[model samples]
Target: MLPAPSRPPRLRALAVAAAGLVVLTSLTGCTQIASAFNGLQQNAVSTPAPRPAVTQAVSMPYDSKFTYDGSVSLSTDVADGLEVRLDVWAADPKRTQEWAPDNDKTFGFAVNVVDHRVDEKAVLTQKRRVYMSMISITSQVSQSTIGQQQMMSPFQFSADPRTLVPSDTMRSDRGLLLNTFQGGLLVPTTTIHQLPADTYGITLQFALQVWVEGTANTDTSFQQQTVYQVLPIAIFSPTTPTQ
Candidate 1:
């Protein structure tokens, strides 16, 4: 059996938020969204999660916006703490533009879709540290081993196991937020796609690429592991697009 995640209070909040998201999604007719990781979780020295602050952006007329539920945890390998850290990424205001700017834009990221260009060259330093490799796993009926399963539609991504801090320094532009943009007026999260009602559950894998210290981690090992929550995905189109 795998060890219980030392999820912090903030992470719990996000987990709850993620749950709430599923409920809200039901209103629009969604299904349980889950992740199936195709890797092994190592038993290394784990660290505490990170505490995130919240911020929101609203429209007076549209009544459209979201709240950032800042919740993250810090995992480590070295005794002192995590040696290498995963670089941070800020709100990509131009994300929609990169893909179909004229296709009606919204400030949010979603799972199972990579419409945006996803600036592979963009890099930003986080205020605190990046916590990743947060995987969700399931145990066998009567076995002392791990399960082996693959996601139906796995999004290819790379992330470092631990947070990183440059020994020397970096450029303002090349810092964490590549373009010096602050986090979204709300929190940046993965939006789930609704599935058919006839389906009991579907496997999903969300990948996040991290630049441990350089451009980004390319290996599939250091990425976050474990199968996350198994919940419903909220399905809804943008009520109204913001110009």
Candidate 2:
């Protein structure tokens, strides 16, 4: 085995918030709703028979107005037999659009997602980090345009992993919200003009990329991997208040 780092390698964590806009208009009152698959999960790790391991699925909201809390749980296998567990959610005030002339025509969501990993056999010799690759949105119910963009890139701290001791339990986690805007609001120059007030079915796609340290002792030996997931969101216009 290659020699370990002079000092214990550090753990690296990442968080991302991605936001985009697409116009949708309701056509009919009879809505064909798709039930939110609460706790949607997929296993990409080990396929061994259940001798003592247990599997569980968590549920997330499927239908709601904009700016509400929505969550999706994740558990997947990554490079070097590492298992990752995390959750993804849309930030509160999921969408914001003001009608004031001075107000910027903007809307966004704070979709936070986190990923942590642990090697099954304690074989990790270096740090591990995961990044939010991309978030996509599409509206088939309104016949609108599709929107997708890379959330955030890995940064300096994220490139460095937290130390992992040989005898340590071997676990770490990082958090991020995927959005194009900062402070949960798009920049003044952003072209995302408004949020649709129509009832429609929308699909959101999320992707994650991971980098795992290798025991080869060379920088080139680091392993890189990616994970992808798709989720559904339902939108309904707020009811007008009685005067």
Candidate 3:
């Protein structure tokens, strides 16, 4: 009831202005809050999602045990029943089972020429003959980083095949007769020194120079030719302790 006393006009006006300022401040604060919330929402919508990580595949080393005691048979369309058989194996079977690049390795190979058209019991001169004059082997190693690496042979073997034969047999300038009274050629073993550290596989290429008779009845019509054979051996990496 005491407030019924009339207030001053200027004071009334000042009170009205203060009330309007409070309302304007409240509206401005609310608008700022709303604008901040909308900015956050827009940022969330515009941002890109993270990408996934990439991984590469790894390859395993080759195993030597797979090729031991393997034989390769070769023949040409020019001759029927004339086959050249090659048998290859590790000199030390136990050691080669775990072949490594640092250690020395030896391999053995045998070459046999067979003429199925003639009797097995026939004498050397009477059968279709294949004379082996030269035997050579070249090697290559497969490496992951270097691709293919060429290697030098530890030993060189070049001889007349007939020289290895018995003195009782008749010798000919043509070379050693593979299909003879005896069996085929046998190379006990050829040693290979240490290879590149990263070698995973080894390839041995065998080249044989030979004189093959055109007819089974006579050796006079012999023609010279070269025969090639490839043999692959896997190599293992040196073992290391796991971390």
After superposing candidate 1, which stretches have Cα over 4 Å from the reference? 1-8, 12-80, 83-190, 214-243
Across residues 71-170, which tens digit of lDDT does each residue of candidate 3 receive? 2333432257787666555554334445667886755455666688778667765677777787766566665443333344422344554444333333
* Minimal lDDT window, size 10, model 3: 40-49
Q: Which residue segments of model 2 deviate by more than 4 Å? A: 1-69, 84-86, 94-193, 214-220, 239-243
Residue range 1-243, candidate 1, lDDT tens digits: 112224346444443443333232342221112111112222222232332333332222211112111112222232122232111111222332121212321122221100112342233332222223222322111111123222232222232212121212222221221111211111232222222222222222333322222222322222322323222111122443323
RMSD of each: 19.9, 20.3, 42.0
Per-candidate Cα lDDT values, in order, are 0.23, 0.27, 0.53
**Count of clashes in candidate 1:** 26
- Better candidate number, 1 or 2, judged by lDDT: 2
Candidate 3: which pairs clash?
none
Candidate 1 positional error at 72, Å: 9.7
